[model samples]
Target: MSTATTQGGPELPQERRLVTEIPGPRSRELFARKQSAVPPGIGTTLPVFVTHAGGGVVVDADGNSLIDFGSGIAVTSVGNAAPRVVERVRRQVADFTHTCFMVTPYESYVAVCEKLNALTPGDHDKRTFLVNSGAEAVENAVKVARHATGRQAVVVFEHGYHGRTLLTMTLTAKNMPYKHGFGPFAPEVYRAPLAYPFRWPTGPDACAEEAAAQAIDMIDKQIGAENVAAVLIEPIAGEGGFVVPARGFLPRILEFCRANGIVFIADEVQTGFARTGDLFACEDEGIVPDIICTAKGIAGGLPLAGVTGRADLLDSVHVGGLGGTYGGNPLACEAALGVLETIEQDKLVERARHIGEIMLPRLEALKERYPIVGDVRGRGAMVAIELVKPGTTEPVPAGPIAARCHAEGLLVLTAGTYGNVLRFLPPLVMPDHLLEEGLSILERAISQG
Candidate 1:
């Protein structure tokens, strides 16, 4: 494996290579060490140990390079080790790492909040509170919603994924892995059906209307709008297979929330920061959520999540009630500033749309060729293909296909509660050729199946 920089000076190889089989020599040794050192509950998508990553490629310890389609589960939107992020983080670390935002506030933290307020979907006066992770952001959003409305109930969708915190786990619908074994979650969280057009018994437009009506009816009958604090949802369901709700669905829900005084929360942890071609996915439907939770890609692989929302709602919480030990570490805030700058200067939002333009046709062709490819959906760069058994709508778990693709040097992720969806979250800066090569590998894997 040769090391050479690209013409653009990004620290990445022009072409990918596989000098050894997956988990070869060095990776095997590292895996053995990891097995002994790391917790078993923390899962890995690929067995290979990542030595270096830049742009859309992850270099393994075994000297194999694979195109990353998962982007660290949608955390590295500006690409892993982007130059801007690296430089900013380095400077911030040298200055200071942490001072505890609660004790001594920093300019960078306030700057990040300013950027979030300016960029997040809403023209109203919005306040932002940075946190350590997506779950923390979700938990804080709940606290603010409850504090603002003096209500206890939070309404979330059936296939929605909030976080792993006790309160968020209760908000999440999945049981086996995320919520399993650690039962007895927090209370007063209600579940509603999302407008999943593929599975719902209606067309996209009608599915949106019906799902909204059903949810409103349920809220009135069961949870009562007055008792609910917020309605939380992912604009495009992330772990639930990139399920894009129909056009009118979010608008109708927003209308209901506004009329009833329930705070509308959009959990954009997976869809924010240009993953869905927009800075926030809610822009597509023209619905500005009252409270928007964001993380993942906000800080370019750093652990920084944010809760940006209506100023009044956020202000309702006591000043001391909304901070963490490392809520907005200096290093993370620097990274976030860099991330936002990168998105704008690099025009990654438009890049996401360009990726979709290239990927959609190829995915459509694959759908035509493979009987198992039941659906192709998602907006911008957050694309997914749902696999199902031929002649029937039964979900065909694509675990084996994903494994084979990983073995052949393509790192992909499976989503959906049934694990039947292959979701792609490639770096927005990925070169066209590399993106096409990854797609070719996907086609080969599916055709082989």
Candidate 2:
């Protein structure tokens, strides 16, 4: 009985049990229905449809409890349907659902903003506004930066993922899937090199100095520092394969933003809310940005995203400049409030550190045993292992390896622009044995391959 699996917590049993093969019969039937009804553009990572999930496992259509390592792509960090979140959302739903914050204000929305202000780094007077998704929040942040600075250019980094919308798609660096055939994207957006330590030409030690100098030089010569409105980056790159930029890379970039008048934005959609040990990943390096974009883990499992920044920068936007119909909906706001309370009360930040302690050594040992394991990196609970060719840096296909894990009961997610990294974002509240079980399953997958 691990401490993470409590007697009073999510009542579902905390173990992985397969009643049938991976997609079983019921899941296959549902998949048939899904294929008929849903568009092909919308893709799913796992084939089994979920019926119930809690603690550390997802109960699929066939009564099989599969170990969850994805956490709904980092949306359910507090664990699916956390008690506090459920209670708050249920109460809010019973009272009211959608009042449209723009039309009529509510306390929950303001309370969530207040939490964002207090929780996010920096002691400066801040203003927070809500949106329905990470893409919308990022779009709003860009709008504020451009308007406040009266500048036209925005700088992004290579191996970064913003979102799926027009501007965000332009901001995103990958091609093929995210941006293929969706060209003529928003202009004046520049992509600079990221301080990717694993692949940096100069090696890890010089990665920070070399990469930073190159990025700054490119922006200064090509984009002109004065014309750039913002430098948007992720403290820990998410969809780009959990790439943690080399040390000194972020600080130098932040320094450049401060010297110039560019708004420094940290998109914490995937790394915020205790997923990275600190409430936000920026805190890990003691770096705080002018504007912060947050979403994925903010509201337990509800849809909520926010842009919080210095009052001067955010307020510079004229009245009626920012908002949406479903932005900060009451139920989501209530759920966010519950999530904040749960983080503080449960001390999940420490739990993230514990998960890392348990995972890193095992993964590093795997790297020693398998030549295909190129690098094992990340912080807190947001860890990943990059796979490559036996004797070189070249990446081999990660799809087949992931499929092997899926064929068994373990649910894992693959990332990286090259598509050769396995990212693990387990719930902080998952029982220790389950986490141990997941690692074992992953070991089996790698060994078999």
Candidate 3:
């Protein structure tokens, strides 16, 4: 409840200051330069270029401080330029950057894996290997699963988002941006129904059981469980919308996986490392996944991911079968170690829960006041409000309202397959004042809409 004790490392002014209009002269000029230099395919959610950031605010090129509710798409949960992260990276960079884990190896890399094995859900002996991104981690997990199970089929859910790589694109559900013209995807990938209470034809009370049964049945009848390698899912769906599956959904799915001998992979890329009230979102169900793919918050702000799972499954693969050139880069590994330490020392897991305690009530209030807000759901700081038509579930485009928030110097983000959800991933270390101010801006934005 008290963020005054939060130390944002860089000693940045916690107060938000708007020196100019959004994307004022300097940022607009920078955007023009970026447009000229960068490819159009590389899109940006906002045109404001960041000059510096720390605590809960991002200072743009125009010297405007905007409250950051996005956390670089959930990358900087420990806060940007966290002291421990910077110190660790500084030491690692000075000594050496990369020696390639598979070749020379490093203690930080092994330490990171050890921490992951200890922190992730299950107690069984686990093995871990690092990767560059969430997509890469998912891909490698699938590879390990197939190799271990001697099966080829991988099942994902509708409204799920894996990544941008070809295989990940195949695993992802939505089209347009992720999987539109990029077809000729990997074969043997199957789709199942998500326990999305908001869109389920059945009501929430019976939705979990119904959807889980339907999904398992489809997989059994269509893909044949024996042929399946893994059932990959996000514990709390991310880009698919911050849709928390109904209570029994994940447990039912995990139960099915157990009976079928299928690997249950919890893709906690966006929800792991204290973003949720728990250390890992899957813990909320007491459902331990056979394989868990993690990234994003694993490192303070560094690019690093890992696949931790049952030792036998990971060990089943041949020696040279796993790992990447930069999979366990020393810098990223050190940064990850720092992140874990910060989480423990700062008690960020508890902080995330406290954030939820503050945010959920405010968001629920908004849902009640605004007809456009159809639902407000999420755990911890990972909260969102789904926008819809006045009296219906029909999506109301969220772009305009999010734009208003941006114009008012609040950095929020839009998610969901249909882009009708506004997700909040505020830093756990964010001061209560910033949190309340950001919410006020959001309320004004939704009101303007």
Candidate 2 lDDT score at position 369 = 94
TM-score of each: 0.97, 0.98, 0.98
The best-first sequence of candidates by TM-score reads 2, 3, 1
Off by over 4 Å in 1: 1-10, 203-205
Candidate 2, 1-449: lDDT as tens digits: 43233222446888888999988999999999999999988898888999888888888989998889999889999989788898888888899899899999999999999989988999999999999999999999999999999999999999999999999999999996999998899999999999999999878999999999999999999989999999999999999999999999999999999999999999999999999999999998889899999999999888999999999999999889999899999999998998888889999999999999999999999999988899999999999999999878899778888888888888999999999999999998888899888998888889987
lDDT score, candidate 1, position 338 = 87
Residue runs of model 3 more than 4 Å from their true location after superposition: 1-10
Report RMSD for candidate 1: 1.9
Tens-place lDDT per residue, model 1, 1-449, is 33333222446673568899886899888888989999999887888988778777889887798988999999998877777788898888888898898898889999999989998887999999999999999999999999999999999997899889899888888886898899888889889889998888766658988999999999999999999999999999999889999889899999999999999999999999999988899999788889999999999988899999999999888758878898888999998988898899999999999999999899999999999999999988999999999856699998999988898889999999788999999989888888899999999999988
Q: Native-vs-model 2 lDDT?
A: 0.92
Which order, best to worst by lDDT?
2, 3, 1
User: 1-449 in candidate 3: lDDT tens per residue?
Assistant: 22222233344677778888887998899889988999988988888999778778888888788899999999999988888888889888999988888888779999999999999998999999999999999999999999999999999998899999999999999897888888899999999999999888878888899999999899989989999999999999999999999999999999989998999999999999999989999999898999999999999888999999999999999989998899989999999999999899999999999999989999899988988999999999899999999888899888999899999989989999888999999998888899999999999998886
